[model samples]
Target: MATEFEMKEIKSGDPEAARHSSMAAPQKSVTVKFENLNYSVSIKAKKTVTEKVILNNVSGMFKPGKFTAIMGNSGSGKTSLLNAGAVKGGKISGDLIINGEKMDTKFMKKMSAFVMQDDVILGTMTVREAITMSALLRLPPEIPKSEKLDRVDEIISMLRLDKAQNTVIGSTRVKGVSGGERKRTGNLIIFKIPAMAMEMVTNPSIILLDEPTSGLDSFTAYSVCTTLSDLAEQGRTVVATIHQPSSDIFLIFDDLLLLSEGRVAYYGPSSAVIDYFTKIDYPFPDYVNPADFIFMHILNNSEEAKQADKKKDALNKVLLEWDNSENKKVMLNTPATQKGLPADVMKVNASFYEQFRFLLTRAGKNVWRNALMVRARLGQAVFLGILLGLVYRDVSSRPLKSQTQALGIFLASVFEDVQVALFLAPMLIMPMMVFSGFLINNNNIPVYFNWIKYLSPIKYGFTAAAKNEFQGLVMTDQFGSLTGEKVLDDLAFTDELPVDQNLYVLLSMFIILIGMAYMALWRATKKVV
Candidate 1:
């Protein structure tokens, strides 16, 4: 039951070409295929909350290389469907297939690239760096660095991002690229944007993009459509949930799979959508786009648009019949037979590195590129050391010096506090670094107080200062003699020992503080992601 567009586009110009395309289809297939795939998410009811049914037994074949749009009103299961297909922990019951092989729920994550509605780009990377880092992490090792750069270059070229190629991607406050540019970069890193497609090896055969043009202008949205259409032409399955696209973008779709209250109301060629509605007596208005018309119709119906209701019975019956009919199953299966494979089918060894050189190169590149950042940070450490050393320069064998040095050592311990804070900086500032060193990852900030977190840098820079300030000091006071505890009670304890025991202890504290901070950072990012 592949839609006509999917079938026609693949079978269009040359039969031999179509055959080759089919051979390239992803291996594996899905079962009972979303048979009764329904879901609901609970929300707290007291805080102006709304209850929603995200999806309802909506099923369809996701053929390789076919561009499909999952059309629906806001809160419909479009995003839910994509999430279910990609991420897990949903209330799922249907089977997803690939080449007749049942898609193991546990393995679905490895098989899909899900670009969420909100752009998930880290704010500090340049376009090429983001894409390159992603390539290093995910691309098959068969693609070399030279080829990877070429691939990045091609994607940058394809996106018409030549002007902003070297621009940093971040918010306006941080000063860098524009929103569209950053969105594209984020997508590129995750393989939703065109720039990363050329060298993508670990990319899922089926791409699920949620609102690929959610925040763009008409022209930009159109550009996104064109890019996706080009991907489809190249024989990759593209599924996107979009809203309010202009007519120009509407036409680029091969199929429009419309949803209403979690049900498939229309799943066919974009050209035939209006006719399908007209045939069902819910004709589109004279000037209304069919996409808009359908959304209006569903919205007017509300949550009460039950299949068995009689007032709007004609529309509901027709759509429901279509869903239950054997023809729909045929539509679901057509892609398989056309490609000579089943759904949920997987092929192509996603394992990119089976060799040592490949892994070492990735590791080496990571270390090399980070060399400057690391050194600059370490230089800050040395500067802190000078400052602290100067601050505690007067520690001596006298009682006054012992008291002063003891206080200095305590202030130096603040460096340990600062070191702890510095390591935590990466946890908050670059969590994804723990993953692939690609971009800085910031967790969600509360709407009211996020600004405070944005300006704080005390955690990262203070520790280095403390460690450099307090090592190798002999401060003696009469209090040590008076107390008989040698705790700086008297100035009696002068030391040749400052360079040995005291220095070693101070150095140990420095190393210990740094080690603790680094370990904390590693664990935080690992756990957070």
Candidate 2:
């Protein structure tokens, strides 16, 4: 029987063997090297500008088939160094070499994926739904739907989320899946790749993570790291910015990159770290967690370190000690570069129409599953319609005819939250009712300030409804004949819009409002950073 790594080698060399292996296994790998990488931002204070350095001259290498951990004390520029790979509105100068050849930002972006610390999955979706939606959007177009689904199933099984596949990842309002399952469900792949379960991850050749285990518990943290290690073992280079790890979790890491005050304190194998530090007079004692031991010494110089400067500037001495160490001589020797990457890497598999259909299907599913919200909305419509008829048993007696209900839909798109629309809807609609020919006759308004009614959607909707109900009717009861035309004249509506014109105006308002909303959201997404 061959080991897993050996089996991966076999699959890569032989097409026949590849067909039988797990599809989630990495198909390619690349070395990620950055030399003298620096990231800074300009801070203006009191008529003077100063450059605040986040990462200062940091250099390191993460090789293929290695689970490298980038750990440091809080505010030590761990996230800054990791994010330097994908510079977003920041002043960054660095040499990023992939497989020993310097690559541009465009090429670097296509080759790697960054997984943030947050697990942001829709609480309404099931585990399978979340993963399948990603798979449908990404994964190569050549692969059949049936095969893509099969790969999704394999990923579900690998993460041991088979039982929770159909469970809803619930929010704080409602109880649903377990915390661990919720975390795992959120780990779906983000970029264009096979929907491999990343759990706050994306499928890219070089995976850089910023604190994958931040909010997780001891056992869950270990489990998350184990999955990362599995990905590394499958030949992909994995880099993660991790915090205080348990001894067991630390042991899972192949290489360790330690930093202090924006400088590389040590960069080498995890096992050799003890010897590396011991040679510099910082000896590690037995029967203590290696992570805790390291943090105790290094974090002593950090800003928040309790009683900092117990000794004279421990940070500078430790950093200087590393500058003269033999480990500093180690350099990134990237493997031979590939002529080209896989065609399906980060490539969209479906056409626009197909993607739209899938998105529509998902929208339908979300609406169906949110039964409470749907039922509440339906109940409101039925209850309100009946109440309106009761209050105004006769149509002519009704006081309100609001057409701005569609404004809620418009507002929802603009605010990007339904609750905001719901809260602000009544406040806006009440003014339209009072000012739009409902409270007093239009002709009785002040001459200088009488133009507000034209802004009211209620003005047109009410006129249209009244014309539709009593346009040709004539009523007489021991009084002069009251024709519908006479009623309109008395209400100062004879010069108002005709029924057909009012109907058209309302329709046009709805369309224009909705179109503006769509444009607002589309523009918001155009921002790259």
- Using lDDT as the measure, which candidate wins? 2
Candidate 2 stretches with Cα past 4 Å from truth are 1-21, 24-27, 40-53, 87-91, 100-110, 187-203, 302-307, 310-312, 320-329, 332-346, 395-463, 466-470, 473-483, 486-505, 526-529
lDDT of model 2, residue 103: 58
Ten consecutive residues with minimal summed lDDT in candidate 1? 432-441
Tell me the tens digit of each residue's lDDT in model 2 across 193-308.
22236322235677777777777788777776777777777778889888898877787788899887788888888877777777666777765667888898755565564656
Q: Count the backbone clashes (under 3 Å) in each candidate.
A: 52, 2
Candidate number of the best TM-score:
2
TM-score of each: 0.64, 0.76
Which residue pairs overlap in candidate 2's backbone? Answer: 187-199, 187-200
Q: Candidate 1 lDDT, tens digit per residue, 26-116?
A: 4332221344566665565777765556777777766555678888766667877876665443456566665455656445554555665
